[model samples]
Target: MRKKVVALVAVLAAAAAGVVVARGCSGDGTSKEARPANPNGEKPASGTSPEDAPRPMGSAVTIVVDASAPPSEKGPEVLFSATWGGSRMNELGRSRPDEANPEAPMSLAMDAKGNMFVLDQVNGRVVRVGPDGKPESVIPLKEQEAAQDMAVTDDGKVAVLDRFNSKSIVMYDEKGGVLGEVPLEGEGLDELGFVTGVFVDGKDVYVEKEHGPLLRIGTTDGQPVDRTEVPGRPTRDGLSYIKAGIIEPEAGRMYISSVDRATMQHRYTREIRQGSEIRGILLLDTDKTGTIYLATLLVQNDQESVVLSCHEPLKGIPTGTAVLPVNTMPEETFRDMAVLDEGGVVYSVRTEQGVSYQKYDCQ
Candidate 1:
């Protein structure tokens, strides 16, 4: 039954390609309210329930997705919204295209200044948007095929994760000048895994290396600082592999996700490596709070995903647990997640159709 479901999901995702503007309900089965109350206690027309109030469901947080603006004269204006409690998304704002291409968008990043950086994977270029949803600049990369994940620094430096060449992480100045590249070394890079994402803090950069572990490196000279092994084994069902990870500097927390594992064959027999059985999002903290928040999705036997927060008061000690409510897209699967200073999260959901950008505000 699990195999059948997984196969069916893959088929539906492949069919969603090329089709623009697809609509579906969230796992919670709630639609976007036509008129909803504002965060400041003002009603907008949509009905409001006390239950709708943003609350923490364990590690699973509340999110809202809105349609900000429609397609513009050049084309449909790109709008970003959060997928919170209801099915409907909240309109954050529309973003204009820096370069025009009919291909669907893959990923996006927003700076503190409201400047939007869009990664058009198909075209192998990065597009920038101004606060008013206008095109600011278009950055063309020399090696488009290697570009995978991206991050923008507070000082406006752009870092692109390349999977093709020896240069793993490449940094560029605000004007698109080559700053430097992080040399892939140490036990983490020696595994020769693909980098899923790159995030920059003040002077440190955190990288999620696929199939290996989380790597921390210095941005100034690309020197490796530390490497943390990712826990969890792949399930025997051969469902998915580890995809991406995120780190929160303020909270000293880390989250990792798995997608599918690979099967290996020897001379006489074939062996299947069980992928990360504890498949979901994991929260790791180094602040002496031995608590770990885990969000898991069972894909092989059952199609269910939940969030749980587990804590240990003292080292090597155990505490109680709590379950949280998390809503996911029916067709879209979450690939990456990042936590903010206020305990909020921004995640990337990838589907055969397109990539869905979602933000979760957790109290």
Candidate 2:
């Protein structure tokens, strides 16, 4: 019932990440010397502010393929794939299969070492995958039913958005030991409702509550640090409310995705200043320069759904767009998405054939 729905949702979420048909990029045979440092070493203007100098737009490229496309031999440059339905289990890299208790693999996080963690919603646990893609450990929750989202710290600690109880970000050690839980403390969060996304960096954890505001919590004692309203137009219909966040510690950038009604799409937009107006209405990963992949279900267009990617930015401005092909398995519907370390995305799609793998390379 609920567990089955969660399993299905997990697979769909994988498809949302654009994991179909593995691909990779290669460099040309020539090399050039590095450019000299700027004499002024001046910082470029920010992309949003008029006072800031405009940043250079990088070149865009796309990779498309049919079902017959061959898988890469170099392992996945990026690993994004689907999960098993009705089982609290998921397969990684076609190698390791992990089983968490209660069988609800809702969210995923990976570390620099290639270790993966799956938020098991039904069993109220988080299962860790080792470097070899096998189950390493599981963090158990006593009463939490729906552990919705997750993020991994640079140090390998896991932070999770526990939706059912208090809706707080719970921190755990790499070995599944409980560190703390940060509770939301602000207006509109009294109910402690569902948290759709969780992101961790250093000792800070950010939680995005569904239909509510975003909360910043301390990783030390699970205390609320800051609360701010999300700046975006409210979505009415055909909206997928799976909010995802990524933090660029080096650039101090935070990227968040929300559903947009104008295009009847879910697009990722960057948030520069806290509570500031969000201007960049494009889909991009943390790198900000890679391919922009999208999973769409255009019900108005005869229920036609497919995974798509664009090398160019997709905002109010018009740019060239392209669609990547994937083999469709009956009964599978694309769901949510996450970018993997290897420059590819992992996505979950529904199919009668059960959960399967699809890899794409950004040309």
Candidate 3:
């Protein structure tokens, strides 16, 4: 492959100065842009200075879809026709079945090629939609009755988590071929009920245990590993692991912390004081360049909205923020937001008609 003329020119300029600058991809075949990651792994003090102040912004909708049943080519897909499709809520606004949420498509994922995978669990299939908002194909999962969340690798491999009924994680190839299925219980994981989300890094499969530690359960081939665990969620670049928490819940203050993936040493913990009534954090993940993306559900004046904040890599420096509208008209959903390898996010919302997947460039 021929190098870009601009890259070659840049290399020559650097070499003329008696220094050879090497080009390196961040393990995703894309060059890692020079980011302001702290070189000394300094643990910056947060929540007390202007550097840790929050910067919030709003997001513009990129895609919208009306709900439709299977065998249709016009939608992200939904299953609201049957009597068992609705989730029951009481006067106190609590689900009767406890953790068994609802029948909507609980999760969504996107491949490196910008293809969307909607886990239509109620319909028993994974709906594939391209970046152009066109339906591509369907990956059927007839046996996943209570699949909670799913993650897709950069190469279009999929790992579906069915923690309730199946207690298993099923792996699938790009063509919807069954690679393997493995149990969730292992060394770092003990209870299936506490498993929160599924994540993919390289060939390894990790399941977040109750929003805490991530237990490396298996691989892309659907075989269980020997029960290794990570302290937090691994970034796509495989260089850092990040964990986030809401410290002053009432004041909407939060902190994002990370450690080096190799040495597991402290990197930085930056606190952000969001100027909204934050209900909770909705999403947290990184792009291929390790740029951090966080979504928090903010409520003010009895209205709830999702506020997205973008930060630079492991340093946790604020880049920008945006507000994503939340579907007040609730359907049963387990996962909503998915980050892209190229610094964007696509999230799904289920309505009375069908599920609509929308994209936002909060990064």
Order of models, best lDDT first: 3, 2, 1
TM-score of each: 0.44, 0.51, 0.72
Task: Name the runs in model 1 displaced over 4 angstroms.
Answer: 1-108, 114-116, 129-135, 185-188, 194-196, 206-277, 282-296, 299-301, 306-335, 340-343, 349-356
Candidates sorted by TM-score, best first: 3, 2, 1
lDDT of 3 by residue, 1-363 (tens): 011112222112222112111121222354421111110001111222334322221221111111111222342222112123432210001122556643556777888998878776766777677766666677778488777788998888889889878789999888999999989866666677777788888899988866657888788999988888788889888899887765545555566778898898877665555444546677788898999887766554465556566777855655555545566653556667788888877766545554556667542
Model 2, TM vs. native: 0.51
Q: Give lDDT tens digits, candidate 2, residues 245-295.
A: 212212222233454434645554322211112111222233123233432
lDDT, candidates in the order shown:
0.37, 0.39, 0.61
Q: Of the candidates numbered 2 and 3, which has the greater TM-score value? A: 3
**Model 3: residues >4 Å from true position, as ranges?**
1-101
RMSD of each: 17.9, 16.1, 13.4
Best by the lDDT measure: 3
lDDT of 1 by residue, 140-243 (tens): 65564545567776556777766555456677676766777766555656544455445555566666544234466657334455654432222112332222
